[model samples]
Target chain A: MSALGHFLETAGIATAGISLVRENTELMRPPRALWVPFELGRPFGAPHAPAFQMRVLLSALALLDRTDGPVILEDFPDDAPESDSTASLVCPVNFPKPPNPDESDLLRAVLAETASLAPWHALFMETHGRSIATVSGLDIDAAARYAAAFLEPRSNPEPPEGRDQASTLRFAIEDLRNWRLEAITAQPGPKPSSKTLADWFWGETATGALALALHPVLLESTSPRLRQVGKGQLVPRAQQHRLG
Target chain B: MVRLSDMTADDAAHLLSKNCPSFPGEPFVAGPPLKERRVAIVTTAGLHRTTDTVFDLTDIGYRVIPGNVQAADLAMSHASVNFDRSGFQDDVNVVFPIDRLREMKAAGEIGAMADFHYSVMGAGWEPHEIEPTALEMAALLHQDNVDAALLVPV
Candidate 1:
């Protein structure tokens, strides 16, 4: 992000940026930056926080008018407001545990879980007027099937048009995960924090179990792309502690 | 919460070891006052219209997001799964902040909003690898008479 700022400033346009990582910003030394204490995905403090978002925005934009020498990295004074932890998310579906350790049973559980989440996901779409699950180019059911197919010993489901198997599997898993997260969040409650949602998805959900089960299978696959996905893309590092 | 102290050791070390390109000289261009400068957002969040192509692992190119874009029309395809996305899922303003920018424009906090904003996936390439794309976007911003750019990352 700071690199882009440097390039834009060099091109004669003044640039100011929100620095999520102050160390990186200090090293690269962009023309002007406001070092925000927010998390990685959220440069502007929190969701649904307009006043705080304005303060962060104004602080960064305020740097543009400074006539001081280049490399101004100011820190935002306050941390982002914490989410309402008292209001816990109540997951609507109660997925039964797989009957056995076999991959087929896990696949069935995941499929059933996907089917159970569909209406809530539909509610998410209805409320938000959008869904990020479109990345895989497959509907929620197809994404579930495509991802679950990977557990088969020799089955290689065809990817969507113009996509390769490894990429398709990665996206299919993302779509299912996103669909599920969106679905669960649509239940009536205060918004959950990212950590809460991640914990629910990675620690308690059947889809999470399916992903954990696939990690080894993909890591052992001959395809380098699938191996790459297994190594890093399939699961977030923060949640890797949950891996069996 | 993204401070290095808050992250796992491995994650913190990975971020510390990530490449950050340095240029020869400090180049700072003087621009108009905040309320008189045309502003645009240059994000590395891999945002695009839902109908647009998804960003590949090593895609260094950028997608143009028009100023009038709706929150529901945007989607993220960033290659990295390391970052938190639930915030963005709940509110587009958390990442894109287009509505905030619009409100700023309405309140006369800035001179004007540019007609276009730019987004690129900030992974799978070296920091210097983004220079060309940045230069291209700078030219486009110039064409739109934008004097100030707010760089956002995810």
Candidate 2:
């Protein structure tokens, strides 16, 4: 999703991802927002294979300039991505899948926690440790279950005991190039009127494998809000290229 | 021949942009041109009807249009979807053409048909997830090797 913003940034298309599941929908920083709170299964991937998961990831980047309005993408099959292999089981680490916690209880926990964000966030934090941020409704437990089912079973490679180190933490904070990002500010430009905003064109300028570089900008020049966007809303278009 | 007015809000589109990079993406790929060639359509507008069993309300987005319908009839009937200030298509299939693609085939614009059209009402938040579906579909299309593909927005 960050990649989409990058491309859009270059394209002068003011693009935003539905990222404020928790705080701001800004996918990360600078030219962000448009955030929607959902699990990876529904938002971007099925589960198991990293390859398929990434395909949908890149596809989202592709939408940077495809539509004028907010774009909601589906990653599941008929309903949601089936990571049942993971979601349905407790843990694949042990020989036989461990008896899972009750789904009814789980469902209840989910419903009861609807208004509360603490437990869910706590759970994710416990399992994954921590990250810059996490989306709402991402139920890591659900992800755990899905992971168990979706990913091919890998024998436990841990040496039984895991060690914690400051180096790891320092590396994560200081050097994770992918995770480290900057918030791109919108350049001042003409703002379009409501009527004009209604006529904006959406398209993609990003391409290639992982596509971390694509970012979509809202073009206000052709619309009514061109003035506001120019002052704020509109993102400049990227370099022109021959569209055959 | 598709007038903007002809389409109901779901039929007409205000603007269109290519998802693939312009410079890198050649008009005609080495194999068959994605145009005038048999193609498959996919949608992230998250479409599935009650009858179809692919629908998921929790999946997010509008479900007015069937996301996975073959793209044959709709292309001709509704050239564009109703325009909104910030949305692609209101009724649905905002990004995939499971319908119009089929119509083109009937009209002889395309030569063959893909076995299955893909649909996902994916609220784009992550990038890794979309990769597999694309690979799966791309591989499917490659195996089928149609002249070209027509990917319309839901």
Candidate 3:
């Protein structure tokens, strides 16, 4: 409903999202999260352009003002071409702090696994990354700090048989942004390789993007509260031959 | 579902009617469907085979063109993926391991072969256009009463 934002705001949905976005002031004036991207039919944005999309977003948020907005959708650029605001990243930017001894040891074990891998193993890993992206306000350090404060260990308790050094290095550096990095950083450890460090960093960006993109699909498959979409969710119907 | 490797198109039609979800009003009938199996796979992300043309699944997201996803395309978007992810620098989209599908079919994970594999142009903020296109093929699979479909998403 155009009333969805009003409903969420007057109710308490905005309060819930406050923690996730860390913009409490915005929460007090809850806006509806548009289900789609781009400028037209839905509140979500278009292909790559970030600023225009965010403006559309902030405008959507402004609609929450029961007293101020009669024409809640005042700024959506109906005329803007359907443009993708962001490009694919060359590498995941934004580095986090380093590792602790146990984490370092864990990194060592993962590297040991990668060191033993066969040349052909690249086949599985090449195609097996996630499709999510992240778009919250939290900086990489805040995200990392949040991670270290509350973390648990899982996966590859020991390296798999025949893992390669670099591959294992990737395994170690993977998702440090989601772990207790400050604690890890505080603890003493050997220097992680430049290669391992980079993998850890890029892996975060890749992982975040994947998380962003596949949200609907994975949620469709798994979430208990089903995500609802209108015909508004229809993807851009262009069939231009994709560039080869 | 007919398990036979080879059957007339009519039998294929009969089987699909019995198995797949029937559309409104139309009797669920089976048999030869689609122009040909001509099936392609699109991953959850944009992964490509190294030997073929490449598509990136990272920040830009996944995309599958009509032909192979080349390494050069993926490399343009993600040099790190090319240098580290691809078993070979030249081949792209190998990460999804369509080669494994080829192997699986050869080793008999199932019968027949996937004629094509696909990737998304980018990640989740945007959605995919393949669903409608798939129904065109799904109708055929439904008609033929195809045994099962295994879609691997990256």
- Give each model a TM-score: 0.96, 0.27, 0.25
Task: Tell me what fraction of the real C-alpha contacts between chains A and B each candidate also makes.
Answer: 0.78, 0.00, 0.00
RMSD of each: 1.6, 22.2, 24.5
Instruction: Please give, for residues A1-244, the per-residue lDDT of candidate 1 as tens digits.
Output: 8888888988998988999999888888888989989888999999889999999999989998888867788999999988765656655447565544466676677778777877888898898888887888888778778888888888778998898788788888887888888898888878777888888888778788888888998999888988998998998888898777
Q: lDDT tens digits, residues A44-134, model 2? A: 2222233443343333333333433333332222222332122111110112111342334333332332223334334533543433211
Q: Could you give candidate 3's per-residue lDDT for residues A1-244 as a string of tens digits? A: 1122222222222201101111211222323222221211112222223444344333432333323322212323343233222312222123232333233333333333223221223332344231111111223333232222211233222223443322222222222222212112222344232224223333433232222222233234232211211011111112001101
Task: Provide the lowest-lDDT 10-residue window in model 3 chain B.
Answer: B22-31
Residues forming the 10-long window of minimal summed lDDT in candidate 2 chain B: B76-85
lDDT of 1 by residue, B37-138 (tens): 999999999999998888888899999999999988998988888888878887899999999999999999999999999999999998888889999999
Best by lDDT: 1
| Local accuracy by lDDT, each model | 0.86, 0.28, 0.27
Span of ten consecutive residues with least summed lDDT in model 1 chain B? B18-27
Model 3 over residues B1-154: C-alpha lDDT tens digits? 0111232344334323331221121111221222222223333333443333332222333334333443333322221221122121222222333333344355443344444434432222212233333444444334443322222221
lDDT, ranked from best to worst? 1, 2, 3
Q: Is candidate 1 or candidate 2 better by DockQ?
A: 1
Extract clashing residue pairs from model 1: none
